[model samples]
Target: MTKHFTMGGTATFDFIELLGGYIVAMTGDFDGGAFARVVGEPRVQGNKTYLDMEHTFIRKDGSTIQTRDQSVLTAVEGEARLLGATTYNVVKTTGAFEGLTGQFRSWGSVDPATGQGVLRFWGSIGEASAKAA
Candidate 1:
Protein backbone atom coordinates (compact mmCIF):
# COMPACT_ATOMS: atom_id res chain seq x y z
CA MET A 1 0.00 0.00 0.00
CA THR A 2 1.12 3.57 -0.64
CA LYS A 3 0.62 6.34 1.89
CA HIS A 4 0.61 9.99 0.84
CA PHE A 5 1.38 13.30 2.50
CA THR A 6 0.83 16.84 1.20
CA MET A 7 2.43 20.04 2.45
CA GLY A 8 2.24 23.71 1.49
CA GLY A 9 4.95 26.20 2.32
CA THR A 10 6.32 29.65 1.51
CA ALA A 11 9.95 30.29 0.59
CA THR A 12 12.28 33.25 0.67
CA PHE A 13 15.14 33.50 -1.82
CA ASP A 14 18.54 34.95 -0.99
CA PHE A 15 21.20 35.50 -3.61
CA ILE A 16 24.67 34.28 -2.68
CA GLU A 17 27.53 35.91 -4.56
CA LEU A 18 30.30 33.52 -3.62
CA LEU A 19 28.27 30.48 -4.64
CA GLY A 20 26.71 32.31 -7.56
CA GLY A 21 23.31 30.91 -6.72
CA TYR A 22 20.21 31.44 -4.64
CA ILE A 23 19.52 29.89 -1.27
CA VAL A 24 15.84 29.30 -0.54
CA ALA A 25 14.57 28.85 2.96
CA MET A 26 10.97 27.86 3.48
CA THR A 27 8.92 27.49 6.63
CA GLY A 28 5.36 26.39 7.14
CA ASP A 29 2.91 25.78 9.96
CA PHE A 30 1.80 22.39 8.75
CA ASP A 31 5.03 20.54 9.72
CA GLY A 32 7.25 23.03 11.41
CA GLY A 33 10.17 24.53 9.46
CA ALA A 34 11.82 22.94 6.45
CA PHE A 35 15.03 24.21 4.92
CA ALA A 36 16.29 23.79 1.37
CA ARG A 37 19.32 25.13 -0.51
CA VAL A 38 19.26 25.37 -4.30
CA VAL A 39 22.12 25.83 -6.72
CA GLY A 40 21.77 26.24 -10.45
CA GLU A 41 23.51 26.87 -13.73
CA PRO A 42 21.86 29.12 -16.27
CA ARG A 43 21.90 28.25 -19.92
CA VAL A 44 20.08 29.39 -23.00
CA GLN A 45 18.68 26.37 -24.75
CA GLY A 46 17.37 27.50 -28.14
CA ASN A 47 15.15 30.56 -27.60
CA LYS A 48 14.28 29.92 -23.94
CA THR A 49 16.56 30.41 -20.95
CA TYR A 50 16.74 27.48 -18.53
CA LEU A 51 17.92 26.96 -15.01
CA ASP A 52 19.19 23.50 -14.10
CA MET A 53 18.89 23.29 -10.33
CA GLU A 54 19.88 20.93 -7.57
CA HIS A 55 18.39 21.25 -4.10
CA THR A 56 17.86 19.48 -0.80
CA PHE A 57 15.36 19.81 2.02
CA ILE A 58 15.73 18.91 5.67
CA ARG A 59 13.12 19.20 8.41
CA LYS A 60 13.81 21.07 11.62
CA ASP A 61 12.92 18.09 13.82
CA GLY A 62 15.92 16.13 12.48
CA SER A 63 13.81 13.66 10.59
CA THR A 64 15.22 11.56 7.72
CA ILE A 65 12.85 12.98 5.12
CA GLN A 66 15.64 14.86 3.39
CA THR A 67 15.36 14.98 -0.41
CA ARG A 68 17.49 15.97 -3.37
CA ASP A 69 15.52 17.77 -6.04
CA GLN A 70 16.08 18.87 -9.62
CA SER A 71 13.92 21.41 -11.36
CA VAL A 72 13.57 23.24 -14.67
CA LEU A 73 11.98 26.67 -14.84
CA THR A 74 10.32 28.23 -17.86
CA ALA A 75 8.48 31.44 -18.65
CA VAL A 76 5.14 31.86 -20.40
CA GLU A 77 2.78 34.65 -21.39
CA GLY A 78 -0.55 34.91 -19.60
CA GLU A 79 -3.91 35.72 -21.18
CA ALA A 80 -3.03 39.40 -21.27
CA ARG A 81 0.00 40.26 -23.38
CA LEU A 82 1.45 42.25 -20.52
CA LEU A 83 1.16 39.40 -18.00
CA GLY A 84 3.75 36.64 -17.61
CA ALA A 85 3.87 33.33 -15.74
CA THR A 86 6.62 30.95 -14.71
CA THR A 87 6.31 27.19 -14.43
CA TYR A 88 8.49 24.46 -12.97
CA ASN A 89 8.92 20.71 -13.17
CA VAL A 90 10.45 19.32 -9.98
CA VAL A 91 11.77 15.81 -9.42
CA LYS A 92 12.92 14.57 -6.02
CA THR A 93 14.86 11.60 -4.64
CA THR A 94 15.28 10.60 -1.00
CA GLY A 95 16.62 7.82 1.18
CA ALA A 96 13.99 8.17 3.89
CA PHE A 97 12.35 5.08 2.48
CA GLU A 98 12.76 2.45 -0.18
CA GLY A 99 11.72 3.63 -3.63
CA LEU A 100 11.23 7.14 -2.33
CA THR A 101 10.62 9.39 -5.29
CA GLY A 102 8.39 12.37 -5.87
CA GLN A 103 7.34 14.58 -8.80
CA PHE A 104 5.89 18.06 -8.41
CA ARG A 105 4.71 20.88 -10.62
CA SER A 106 4.49 24.54 -9.67
CA TRP A 107 3.60 27.91 -11.13
CA GLY A 108 4.15 31.53 -10.11
CA SER A 109 3.13 34.92 -11.40
CA VAL A 110 3.42 38.39 -10.00
CA ASP A 111 0.55 40.74 -9.29
CA PRO A 112 1.41 43.55 -11.67
CA ALA A 113 0.13 46.28 -9.40
CA THR A 114 1.67 45.03 -6.14
CA GLY A 115 4.79 43.36 -7.61
CA GLN A 116 4.23 40.38 -5.32
CA GLY A 117 4.32 36.86 -6.75
CA VAL A 118 2.38 33.79 -5.60
CA LEU A 119 3.84 30.31 -5.88
CA ARG A 120 2.04 27.00 -5.38
CA PHE A 121 3.12 23.38 -5.81
CA TRP A 122 1.81 19.86 -5.22
CA GLY A 123 3.82 16.62 -4.90
CA SER A 124 2.98 12.96 -5.03
CA ILE A 125 5.07 10.04 -3.75
CA GLY A 126 5.23 6.65 -5.42
CA GLU A 127 5.55 3.13 -4.06
CA ALA A 128 7.31 4.21 -0.89
CA SER A 129 8.25 1.67 1.77
CA ALA A 130 9.72 2.74 5.07
CA LYS A 131 11.19 0.51 7.77
CA ALA A 132 7.81 0.64 9.45
CA ALA A 133 6.32 -0.56 6.20
Candidate 2:
Protein backbone atom coordinates (compact mmCIF):
# COMPACT_ATOMS: atom_id res chain seq x y z
CA MET A 1 0.00 0.00 0.00
CA THR A 2 1.03 3.56 -0.57
CA LYS A 3 1.04 6.36 1.97
CA HIS A 4 0.36 9.93 0.95
CA PHE A 5 2.12 13.09 2.02
CA THR A 6 1.43 16.76 1.48
CA MET A 7 3.92 19.46 2.33
CA GLY A 8 4.30 23.13 1.58
CA GLY A 9 7.28 25.34 2.17
CA THR A 10 8.98 28.61 1.45
CA ALA A 11 12.42 28.41 -0.14
CA THR A 12 15.33 30.68 -0.79
CA PHE A 13 18.20 30.17 -3.16
CA ASP A 14 21.77 31.33 -3.52
CA PHE A 15 22.94 31.23 -7.08
CA ILE A 16 26.35 30.79 -8.68
CA GLU A 17 27.37 31.48 -12.23
CA LEU A 18 27.92 28.68 -14.67
CA LEU A 19 28.88 28.56 -18.33
CA GLY A 20 25.60 27.34 -19.73
CA GLY A 21 23.33 27.83 -16.75
CA TYR A 22 23.34 28.51 -13.03
CA ILE A 23 23.74 26.46 -9.89
CA VAL A 24 21.88 27.06 -6.68
CA ALA A 25 21.98 26.08 -3.07
CA MET A 26 18.48 26.27 -1.65
CA THR A 27 17.18 26.27 1.89
CA GLY A 28 13.64 26.16 3.15
CA ASP A 29 11.28 25.71 6.10
CA PHE A 30 8.31 23.44 5.69
CA ASP A 31 4.93 23.56 7.41
CA GLY A 32 5.62 20.70 9.78
CA GLY A 33 8.91 22.27 10.80
CA ALA A 34 10.97 20.05 8.56
CA PHE A 35 14.00 21.64 7.00
CA ALA A 36 14.92 21.36 3.33
CA ARG A 37 18.08 21.91 1.39
CA VAL A 38 18.79 21.50 -2.28
CA VAL A 39 21.59 21.66 -4.80
CA GLY A 40 20.39 22.28 -8.30
CA GLU A 41 21.43 23.40 -11.71
CA PRO A 42 19.08 25.36 -13.92
CA ARG A 43 20.04 25.70 -17.52
CA VAL A 44 18.64 27.98 -20.13
CA GLN A 45 19.02 27.05 -23.74
CA GLY A 46 17.23 28.85 -26.51
CA ASN A 47 13.73 29.44 -25.14
CA LYS A 48 13.77 26.47 -22.82
CA THR A 49 14.91 26.02 -19.25
CA TYR A 50 15.60 22.83 -17.38
CA LEU A 51 16.38 21.86 -13.82
CA ASP A 52 18.33 19.00 -12.34
CA MET A 53 18.17 18.93 -8.58
CA GLU A 54 18.64 16.93 -5.45
CA HIS A 55 16.55 17.57 -2.37
CA THR A 56 17.37 16.80 1.22
CA PHE A 57 14.84 16.78 4.04
CA ILE A 58 16.22 16.99 7.54
CA ARG A 59 14.51 15.95 10.69
CA LYS A 60 15.00 17.40 14.16
CA ASP A 61 17.52 14.73 15.04
CA GLY A 62 19.64 15.63 11.98
CA SER A 63 18.90 12.52 9.98
CA THR A 64 17.95 13.07 6.36
CA ILE A 65 15.99 11.80 3.39
CA GLN A 66 17.29 12.59 -0.07
CA THR A 67 15.70 12.67 -3.50
CA ARG A 68 16.72 13.47 -7.03
CA ASP A 69 14.48 15.00 -9.67
CA GLN A 70 14.60 16.68 -13.05
CA SER A 71 12.08 18.93 -14.76
CA VAL A 72 11.44 21.68 -17.21
CA LEU A 73 10.67 25.17 -15.95
CA THR A 74 8.30 27.47 -17.79
CA ALA A 75 8.33 31.20 -17.38
CA VAL A 76 5.01 32.94 -17.12
CA GLU A 77 5.00 35.60 -19.77
CA GLY A 78 4.86 39.14 -18.44
CA GLU A 79 5.41 37.83 -14.92
CA ALA A 80 8.40 37.10 -12.76
CA ARG A 81 7.29 33.56 -12.02
CA LEU A 82 8.51 30.22 -13.24
CA LEU A 83 6.59 27.01 -12.66
CA GLY A 84 7.62 23.40 -12.83
CA ALA A 85 6.44 19.87 -12.20
CA THR A 86 8.68 16.92 -11.48
CA THR A 87 8.80 13.55 -9.84
CA TYR A 88 11.26 13.25 -7.01
CA ASN A 89 12.65 9.80 -6.39
CA VAL A 90 13.99 8.69 -3.09
CA VAL A 91 17.71 8.20 -3.34
CA LYS A 92 18.71 7.87 0.28
CA THR A 93 17.15 7.51 3.69
CA THR A 94 18.29 7.45 7.28
CA GLY A 95 17.10 7.12 10.84
CA ALA A 96 13.32 7.24 10.92
CA PHE A 97 13.30 7.34 7.15
CA GLU A 98 15.13 4.10 6.70
CA GLY A 99 13.81 1.97 3.89
CA LEU A 100 11.61 4.83 2.71
CA THR A 101 11.38 4.76 -1.06
CA GLY A 102 8.90 6.39 -3.42
CA GLN A 103 8.29 9.35 -5.67
CA PHE A 104 6.63 12.71 -5.10
CA ARG A 105 5.12 14.75 -7.93
CA SER A 106 5.96 18.29 -6.94
CA TRP A 107 4.86 21.64 -8.31
CA GLY A 108 6.54 24.91 -7.44
CA SER A 109 7.52 28.37 -8.56
CA VAL A 110 10.49 30.61 -7.97
CA ASP A 111 11.24 34.23 -8.56
CA PRO A 112 14.57 34.63 -10.27
CA ALA A 113 15.16 38.13 -9.01
CA THR A 114 14.94 37.40 -5.30
CA GLY A 115 15.65 33.71 -5.45
CA GLN A 116 12.71 33.06 -3.19
CA GLY A 117 9.54 31.08 -3.70
CA VAL A 118 6.97 28.70 -2.30
CA LEU A 119 6.38 25.08 -3.18
CA ARG A 120 3.71 22.48 -2.56
CA PHE A 121 4.07 18.74 -2.88
CA TRP A 122 1.55 15.93 -2.73
CA GLY A 123 2.35 12.34 -3.47
CA SER A 124 2.37 8.78 -2.27
CA ILE A 125 5.24 6.73 -0.96
CA GLY A 126 5.68 3.01 -0.62
CA GLU A 127 8.42 0.42 -0.39
CA ALA A 128 10.65 -0.02 -3.41
CA SER A 129 9.41 -3.54 -3.81
CA ALA A 130 5.82 -2.53 -3.37
CA LYS A 131 5.98 0.16 -6.02
CA ALA A 132 7.54 -2.19 -8.50
CA ALA A 133 4.25 -4.01 -8.59
Candidate 3:
Protein backbone atom coordinates (compact mmCIF):
# COMPACT_ATOMS: atom_id res chain seq x y z
CA MET A 1 0.00 0.00 0.00
CA THR A 2 1.12 3.59 -0.68
CA LYS A 3 0.31 6.49 1.62
CA HIS A 4 0.44 10.08 0.42
CA PHE A 5 1.65 13.21 2.16
CA THR A 6 1.52 16.72 0.73
CA MET A 7 3.28 19.89 1.79
CA GLY A 8 3.11 23.36 0.24
CA GLY A 9 5.42 26.27 0.90
CA THR A 10 7.25 29.23 -0.58
CA ALA A 11 10.92 30.02 -0.44
CA THR A 12 12.87 33.24 -0.83
CA PHE A 13 16.50 33.57 -1.77
CA ASP A 14 18.74 36.51 -0.96
CA PHE A 15 22.31 37.14 -1.86
CA ILE A 16 24.62 37.64 1.07
CA GLU A 17 27.43 40.08 0.46
CA LEU A 18 29.45 39.34 3.53
CA LEU A 19 28.94 35.62 3.14
CA GLY A 20 29.59 35.98 -0.58
CA GLY A 21 26.69 33.72 -1.43
CA TYR A 22 22.97 33.26 -1.07
CA ILE A 23 20.56 32.22 1.68
CA VAL A 24 17.15 30.69 1.27
CA ALA A 25 14.31 31.24 3.72
CA MET A 26 11.19 29.10 3.57
CA THR A 27 7.75 29.32 5.15
CA GLY A 28 4.29 27.75 5.07
CA ASP A 29 2.25 24.83 6.41
CA PHE A 30 4.46 21.94 5.30
CA ASP A 31 7.56 24.03 5.48
CA GLY A 32 10.14 24.69 8.18
CA GLY A 33 13.72 25.82 8.04
CA ALA A 34 12.46 29.31 7.39
CA PHE A 35 15.47 30.61 9.22
CA ALA A 36 17.74 27.86 7.95
CA ARG A 37 20.67 29.32 6.07
CA VAL A 38 23.20 27.82 3.68
CA VAL A 39 26.58 28.87 2.36
CA GLY A 40 28.16 27.49 -0.77
CA GLU A 41 29.39 28.19 -4.26
CA PRO A 42 27.28 28.15 -7.39
CA ARG A 43 28.14 26.08 -10.41
CA VAL A 44 26.71 25.22 -13.80
CA GLN A 45 26.56 21.83 -15.42
CA GLY A 46 25.31 22.01 -19.01
CA ASN A 47 22.19 24.13 -19.02
CA LYS A 48 21.72 23.74 -15.27
CA THR A 49 23.05 26.31 -12.88
CA TYR A 50 22.86 25.27 -9.24
CA LEU A 51 23.89 26.32 -5.79
CA ASP A 52 25.15 23.67 -3.45
CA MET A 53 24.17 24.68 0.07
CA GLU A 54 24.65 23.49 3.61
CA HIS A 55 22.25 24.56 6.29
CA THR A 56 20.37 23.51 9.41
CA PHE A 57 16.73 23.28 10.37
CA ILE A 58 15.56 24.03 13.91
CA ARG A 59 12.07 22.95 14.76
CA LYS A 60 9.69 24.65 17.16
CA ASP A 61 10.41 21.88 19.65
CA GLY A 62 14.07 22.97 19.63
CA SER A 63 15.43 19.95 17.80
CA THR A 64 17.76 20.58 14.89
CA ILE A 65 18.98 18.74 11.77
CA GLN A 66 21.61 19.50 9.17
CA THR A 67 20.90 19.58 5.43
CA ARG A 68 22.82 19.73 2.22
CA ASP A 69 20.77 21.06 -0.70
CA GLN A 70 21.51 21.44 -4.37
CA SER A 71 19.04 23.61 -6.24
CA VAL A 72 19.14 23.55 -10.02
CA LEU A 73 17.51 26.20 -12.11
CA THR A 74 17.79 23.97 -15.18
CA ALA A 75 18.69 20.44 -16.11
CA VAL A 76 20.82 19.16 -18.94
CA GLU A 77 18.34 18.38 -21.69
CA GLY A 78 16.68 15.48 -19.84
CA GLU A 79 18.56 14.41 -16.75
CA ALA A 80 18.22 14.47 -12.98
CA ARG A 81 20.58 14.16 -10.08
CA LEU A 82 20.04 13.26 -6.45
CA LEU A 83 20.02 16.72 -4.92
CA GLY A 84 20.34 15.80 -1.24
CA ALA A 85 18.52 14.54 1.81
CA THR A 86 16.78 16.16 4.77
CA THR A 87 16.05 14.88 8.29
CA TYR A 88 14.51 17.34 10.73
CA ASN A 89 12.02 17.81 13.46
CA VAL A 90 8.43 18.37 12.38
CA VAL A 91 6.15 20.48 14.56
CA LYS A 92 2.78 19.33 15.69
CA THR A 93 0.12 21.75 14.61
CA THR A 94 -3.66 21.81 14.65
CA GLY A 95 -3.89 19.05 12.04
CA ALA A 96 -0.76 16.95 12.36
CA PHE A 97 1.66 15.53 14.89
CA GLU A 98 3.81 17.94 16.84
CA GLY A 99 7.32 16.74 16.09
CA LEU A 100 8.78 14.38 13.50
CA THR A 101 11.66 14.14 11.04
CA GLY A 102 11.32 13.75 7.31
CA GLN A 103 13.40 13.27 4.18
CA PHE A 104 12.93 14.88 0.73
CA ARG A 105 14.54 14.87 -2.69
CA SER A 106 13.98 17.24 -5.61
CA TRP A 107 14.51 17.32 -9.37
CA GLY A 108 14.26 20.08 -11.96
CA SER A 109 14.14 20.56 -15.68
CA VAL A 110 13.59 23.29 -18.25
CA ASP A 111 11.12 23.42 -21.10
CA PRO A 112 12.81 23.20 -24.43
CA ALA A 113 10.32 25.48 -26.10
CA THR A 114 9.70 28.04 -23.36
CA GLY A 115 12.90 27.67 -21.40
CA GLN A 116 10.82 27.72 -18.22
CA GLY A 117 12.18 25.70 -15.34
CA VAL A 118 10.10 23.15 -13.52
CA LEU A 119 10.80 21.30 -10.30
CA ARG A 120 9.27 18.18 -8.82
CA PHE A 121 9.81 16.73 -5.38
CA TRP A 122 9.06 13.62 -3.35
CA GLY A 123 9.32 13.30 0.37
CA SER A 124 8.61 10.95 3.23
CA ILE A 125 7.75 11.79 6.80
CA GLY A 126 7.93 8.75 8.99
CA GLU A 127 6.46 5.84 7.03
CA ALA A 128 4.13 8.01 4.97
CA SER A 129 5.32 9.12 1.54
CA ALA A 130 4.07 12.29 -0.09
CA LYS A 131 2.84 12.56 -3.65
CA ALA A 132 0.76 15.27 -5.33
CA ALA A 133 -1.88 14.64 -2.70
Residue-wise C-alpha lDDT for candidate 3, range 1-133, written one tens digit per residue: 5433444444444445575444544455445543333346657667656665555544454544455565555444345432322333343322343333455554434333432333344555543445575
Per-residue C-alpha lDDT of model 1 across residues 1-133, encoded as one tens digit per residue: 6755454555544445576444545555324333333446556554345444444445455433444454444444553211222232334534443355555444454333433344554555455457763
Candidate 1 deviant stretches above 4 angstroms? 29-41, 45-47, 64-99, 109-118, 128-133
Model 2 global lDDT (CA atoms, 0 to 1): 0.59
Residue 91 miss distance in model 1 (angstroms): 7.6
Q: Which lDDT value does model 3 have at 2?
A: 42
Query: What's the TM-score of each model vs. the native?
Result: 0.52, 0.65, 0.43
The 10-residue segment of model 3 with minimum total lDDT is 85-94
lDDT of 3: 0.45
lDDT of 1: 0.44
Among the numbered candidates, top TM-score falls to 2
How do the residues 15-133 of candidate 2 rate in per-residue lDDT, one tens digit apiece? 34442232333233332223333346568876558877666666566656677877667777788877866677889877756776777766777777855555566655545565443
TM-score of model 3 (CA atoms): 0.43
Stretches off by above 4 angstroms in model 2 are: 1-47, 130-133
Clashes of 3: 5
Ten residues in a row with the worst lDDT in model 1? 80-89
